[model samples]
Target: MDPVDIGLWGVPLAILAGAIRVSTPFLFVSLGECLTERSGRINLGLEGTLIFGAMSGYAIAYETGSPFLGVAAAALAGVVFGLFHGWVCKFKGVNDIAIGIALMLLGTGLAFFFGKPYIQPVAPKLPSISLGGWSDVPQVQAALQVNVLFLFGAVLAVFLWWMFRATRVGLVIRVVGDSSDAARAMGLNADRVRLLSTAAGGAFAGIAGAYLSLYYPGSWNEGVSSGQGLMAVALVIFARWNPINCFWAALLFGGAGALGPALQSVGVSEGYYLFFAAPYVLTLGLLIATSSPERAMQGAPAELSITK
Candidate 1:
């Protein structure tokens, strides 16, 4: 069989691998957003947080020679960003969406400026678990090599889902998100709760950034996030703020994202670029289909700014 013909068969294999690899960032970011939105806060600035995390993670990993440290640094940075965003939005007349946009610009700017020095440096990559060892085909083996972060993300989704369903912390967040006045009546600090949730969400976005720079594409670049952070908000909505559903939705987006490159690799060049836009198109479609004000509002937290 011709090499290209063989490559055709590899398309599905490539997509399978790409889905696992690509979906990871989405999973982390969506999970984080899920937490934030669950608390009735919307953070549009996660995109900036994502870029800054990639830059900081790469620089730290390059300096420390430890990818794990880089991940830690990214998480810390995310926490700071999230906290600031939460604090500022707590003020009356301040819009969360506008603040989020500003933060996104700030994060992206800082990342590009600080990350310039690390562009040429090679940082250590995170390790992957070889699940395809049983397969004789190189494609199968490559496709089966899953990253540790992906597994962690999967576990996190389950944990978040369970937390929401069963935990005291989750209950408090839900209450604040549902009605701040009610939360205050219950003696809960609604503002503090949102601040913490937003911070946690930022940490997740940071980890997602670390995964991009230190694992998959494995480098510091301005385009590292490719808007995955921003898109995650939509993913969270598509999942109806359910963590487990976010996991599945992320994988679906990842597969859609991989379709173009996978097809191009198999010599299918016609309109392959469109495949790159598949995730975004799907997001729009999902929103259109599910976005009747009453329907969208049903699952949305009563205190959420978007729904309001």
Candidate 2:
């Protein structure tokens, strides 16, 4: 292909590739947060959990020469963090949001502290499926190398969506989230439900971290996660706690993330940082548009302080 043809076709292909690469973390965290929020709780500590997961997953994978094991370790770490958060919030006076922020800080600090040595070494990267193998073009082949986590995230979204509508367990979680009192009347243990849901959410966040460190960027560093975890919370809100909506919203955020680099590659690199900020800006604007003083109060869980 000539330069012009490459620019026109290659750039779009790269953007799509970037979108897929960038969206995996959002997919995991957003869907995880969807579960947590649906259980009538929010865990913002996922930001910290994500970074820690990245660090731990990379470190373990490097040491063991097994990427899957690294992912498992990351999930375990996330579950530990989630359990801590759940335990703390179980107390009557503790604030889940405040705890989430604290956990975020804690998780970040822990990752940085432990990740210093591992930062220098490169670990094995996750394997990608090359669906574009039929194409002879190198660029097409590279663009078609899809991450396994992307497929996992998609399957998880569909499973959760179905579970929420059809499963008794899903019904129980929704009931707990919608009304603890109602759940209690139904003889369901609300605290236990929230605890398990939050922990599972954290595990998902860890898997996201694993994908970041062991796959895309393919290494561990303190700077690996730049607010993707927190942004995912906003994403879940924008998605209205729907796992299916979370999938589309994550892809949108992913596409927004690719805008800067895609523009730069085309020699239109002005306002690079602003392009990087596009996802956050879009997220903020969505939040403002969706939120109404009256309606927020009506739609938000009575226990949630954000709307109140």
Task: Kindly provide the TM-score of model 1 when superposed on the true structure, using C-alpha atoms.
Answer: 0.96
The C-alpha lDDT values of all candidates are: 0.92, 0.88
Candidate No. with top TM-score:
1
Q: How does residue 278 of candidate 2 score in lDDT? A: 89
- Top candidate (lDDT): 1
Error of 2 at 46 (Å): 0.6
* Residue 206, model 1, lDDT: 96
Q: Which stretches of candidate 2 lie over 4 Å from their true place?
A: 1-4, 294-303
> What does candidate 1's lDDT look like per residue over 1-308, in tens digits?
12233556778877888899999999999999999999999999999999999999989999999999999999999999999999999999999999999999999999999999999989999999999788667677778999999999999999999998899988999999999999999999999999999999999999999999999899999999989998998888889999999999999999988898888877889987778899889888888877887677667788988887
What's the lDDT for residue 80 in model 1? 99
Question: What's the TM-score of each model vs. the native?
Answer: 0.96, 0.94
Pairs of colliding residues, candidate 2: none
What C-alpha lDDT, on a 0 to 100 scale, does residue 93 get in candidate 1?
96
For model 2, give the RMSD to the true fold: 2.0
Clashing pairs in 1: none
